[model samples]
Target chain A: MKSKKWLFFVILIITTPLLATTIEVCSDCQIKTIKAALSVAKPNDIIKVKKGVYKETNLIIDKSLTIIGENQPTIDGQLKGDIFKIKSDKVVIKGFNIINVGKDFANSNTAIRVQKSNNFEISYNRFENILFAVYIEKSSYGKIINNKIFGNAKTEINSGNGIHLWDSKHILITNNYIEKMRDGIYLEFASNCEVVNNFSTKNVRYGLHFMFSNDNSYLKNKFLSNGAGVAVMFSKRIKMMNNQFLKNWGTASYGLLLKEINDAEIKHNIFEENTIAINVEGSNRIDYENNNFTRNGWALKVRGACYNNVFKKNNFLYNSFDVSWNSKMNDNLFEHNYWSEYSGYDLDKNGVGDVPYRPVKLFSYIVNKTPETIILLRSLFINLVDFSEKVTPVFTPDFLIDNQPQMKPIL
Target chain B: MFKILKYSFYDLIRSRWSFIYLMFYFLLGVVLLFLNNNLSNAIVTLLNVVTVLVPLIGTIFGVMYYYDSKEFTELLLAQPIKRSNIFLGQYFGVAISLSISLIVGLGLPFIYYGLFISDKIFEFLTLIIVGTFLTFIFTAISFFIAISFENKIKGFGIAILVWLLLAVIYDGIFLISLIYFEQYPLDVFSLGAVMLNPIDLARTLMLLKLDISALLGYTGAVFKKFFGTNFGVILSYLILIFWTIIPILGIVWKSNKKDF
Candidate 1:
């Protein structure tokens, strides 16, 4: 009996080393394809792809494998098909330059398609000229981090998105640079996703386009120079904080477009040089706090049908139009917001102004009526018109007034 | 024509794949809505769901409905009816059934929320109707595609690709043009550019109705100036209606000209 127990212990120790395998894949090696390497790899195995342009087609992995490319290996789709198709849990595809995915106008064909996978880490890959760089569908608990996706999309008729996620949950897309696609990061029916610290610029459409996605948090991202800055629609309980929306300048361009969003907390963000800082509609129970709006065309353009929104402790500086509302009055509360245009004195030396500052400009009212009057912006007549309207508010909504504008810039 | 409509409805309802798809989508929408809790969030969620699911289902179902019913279509053609009637009936029936399923899956939640919880009931209802109509538009396009292609795989593939373009790719193209002409007066360009996309039109219309067109800045101002009033709103609706009707009419014209 003592000999049998000793034998069992010896067998257990011998088999542990065989479980974790490390395979190397080179361009001219016996196993040339990533799929071939993944086929034979065991769980927890590391398949290292060597540096070279691999003109491979679709690669599917069904095991818990770690595919790491060394020296920034290139996986060229050759305009044929998807590069990596992951169907396993705990899979990592990293450090590869994926390019030239086939453009299929009928379906969302992506470079990296993750399906029914969990605990994935897609990091440090460079994607160029692809329909969709990274696509996650029906996947859960994935992290798409530190990837660069750029496309030269000329027309909306054939171009694809950058990072397209559908029916995915618990996703973390962080610290990536995405440009020149339809959307930098698109979330459709995705939930509990966290998009952080990414730079999305020069996209054909929205930097971030999310719909029907809920309980998401987008923090510390920079959205710049897109057609529209970002659109958060049909979502609830979203938290957007500490982001920079800059230079999203266009006729219809905006820093952030919030539609049908509820119970959101937008705080500590910066909106600079956009056409409109925040275009809000049909949203409710939102708290806008500690934001800096500088040099935007309109700092906050509040449409009608919004209710129970609170704007507090935000700094509005040098905006053309501080606020423009369509209706006479709204239930949305604007208090403690620092308006640089505030003329009321603070004799008591408190930070708060003595009198309430009305943020809605009279020129904005004129522009609302005759949009052609916008050509006269920055003119003395417009300034005079604005001044007279401030002294005696007319055409502009009567009750749409900012009650406690700050005496000094909130900085 | 009536027989075609009846059969199309019967086929869609009878198919196990459609049932499963509807069940999955309904479950997804309901679960997401319940989780969102807030009306704005729910609306965003609903929009996202509709954007992805509507196009996907429309393309796939439309393609498959035509392909799978080929034998039935031939059998019907052997009878004494006009090809246009058969095609129109099938098209309308497919559109109606899919729209009903979509309404039940996504629309019902918004209605439930609007009636029980919020005041923007009419606005939400309008959005749902627009979404449903958009799906019908896509379905009509899919029918044209199905008739155009000889191979089922090719037709399905083309339909999916078109869906991707409309749902995701078109926005990318708009961004590129905006960037390329960054030095020019972009507001006028944007107004004209956005009109090229029906989805963008729907989105703009919804925003206008919500009185948030000003948020679009110069572009929004221009849009409001042109369409902010009741007349403007009516014009926007007319554009949407034109988008829907023109494509279907084109398909009808093409179907009549071609020997299917």
Candidate 2:
């Protein structure tokens, strides 16, 4: 009797695929619309949409269904409202070109809004001119991959983010290309997420922004020419690695802006040609290693009260100002870094300078005090003053020196 | 005018002070580049030296050349040349010689340092051009001062005073006013003030090249729009040319009306 029951369970497991039906929706099909098909489909069914333009809005999917598109079928929202609203678990959406989601200032009208859903997958979709593309709120264990999001956003107020997460956990966002949105990706109160292998460029605001997000790691991303750059604020234990921050040029802009962050690890990143490479304020216990800061106006501008940060094995090449601090006291450590302007000799030739390298210049301090004195930059008077100040420390932080500056670049 | 220019240029180039000036620049360039091994820092140092020293040297050379050439001027006045042609030719001769010394002296070391192949070539070019402009402008102003005054000592003293005023005191007054009127919007005022002074204008141009305009965070938008764009660069060049012309016109006017 037990052997017969085991055989019956095996038969049920094998025949489940045959029990689930695949419904096709196209222009000439009997189930002509996605809404009609969704109304009739049961749990664990697949809704395959063929190549046609589907004008729809406020699509509510509340079942465990797979909605797949053939030959890139387009869903046009006609500027009405959100296109897909998923409130169920184990839902998969793929291979659709969604366009023209509405912009409502009072509420976030998104292209795809996932709420309280777990184990969902949103991949291989294209979004054009969307307000908020693939916004996940209070969702967990979801994967957003290989999506192309583009918007013609001009201002921060009227547009929304490309990929926005709020209170979402354990999310994986990878291989996405996003541009010209307010922010390429934004996370607020999200934790334990991984963002990898994405390209973000030319946004009106930050390329990637995190606020109060913890234990998140982003790797191998490219952020280029945004209004600002990437910003990490009020976050803890985040890891950022192998990212390229390029050409973020503005008066107040930086390649990475860290404020109130704690215990973060930033390694193997490239910050090139930014106005300011790294702008830190009130951040503590951060480890910055093996990063390259090249051709920036100011490589590092540290504000007051930032402590216990360790900067090691970084290359600072050809920047106008290698390091600028606004305060007279420093609790941070700079060691084993390669500064292109290091002038001390190493007689033993062990690839490290014999003397300490003071990165701060008195001219930077004067510029901070009287910004108008910047007109005197490159002036002989300023150089003379700087030389005198270097010989005898008067204004700049005397303790802010790299004790072991490398003789060569930290390749 | 061309013949007079050729003769005076040859005369000045072969003189001792010109060689000393040339050697001075060459030594400064080599020391800055070799000691610092930094192209950007060298440019900054070159900028400061060029701005302050170029005007002073130009003024001193102009006054000395005028006084030393008085006998030659009297001899040339007896010739068939027009008075304006002689004075303008001599002015161009002194200006061109000083500019060549400045350029060739600075250029050799920089080119040796691979500045032409570097991205800093534009900034270096701007520095050279501005230095040349300052030499010409200050030389012409000194010529005007020398021609206006019969007494050589008075002309020399006043020319040096003019350099001191424009190069240092004018900035002091400009800063005082900027601080005094910090409540008001000073973009237009500062822009106009910078345009009025050649040294300040040259400094502004260099700042635009070095990308330090971004450090001027509050009023940077105006400067960026003005100096970051192609049209603004052209406007600045036009203004610089206008500055060059006014002093030349003053020289011609003063030279023609003088009772030589």
Q: Which candidate is the best by TM-score?
A: 2
Those runs of model 2 whose alpha carbons end farther than 4 Å from true positions after fitting are A1-13, A16-20, B6-70, B97-128, B142-193, B217-235, B257-260
How many residue pairs collide in each prediction? 30, 0
TM-score of chain B of 2: 0.97
Residue range A164-192, candidate 1, lDDT tens digits? 88999999999999999989899999999
The weakest ten consecutive residues by lDDT in model 2 chain A span A372-381
Model 2 residue B214 distance off true place after TM-score fit, in angstroms: 2.5
lDDT of 1 by residue, B21-111 (tens): 6676677667866775556545544554555567678778888888888888888888898888888889888888887776676656556
Give the docking tier of candidate 2.
acceptable
Score each candidate by Cα lDDT. 0.80, 0.89
Q: DockQ of candidate 2? A: 0.29
Residue-by-residue lDDT tens digits, candidate 2, A1-411: 999999999999999877879999999999999999999999889999999999999999999899999999999999998999999999999999999999885778899999999999999999997899989999999999999999889999999999999999999999999999999999999999999999999999999999999999999999999987899999999999999999998777889999999999999999998998999999999999999999888899898879899999999987878898987677889999999878899999999999898899987876565555555555444566677887788878889999999999987
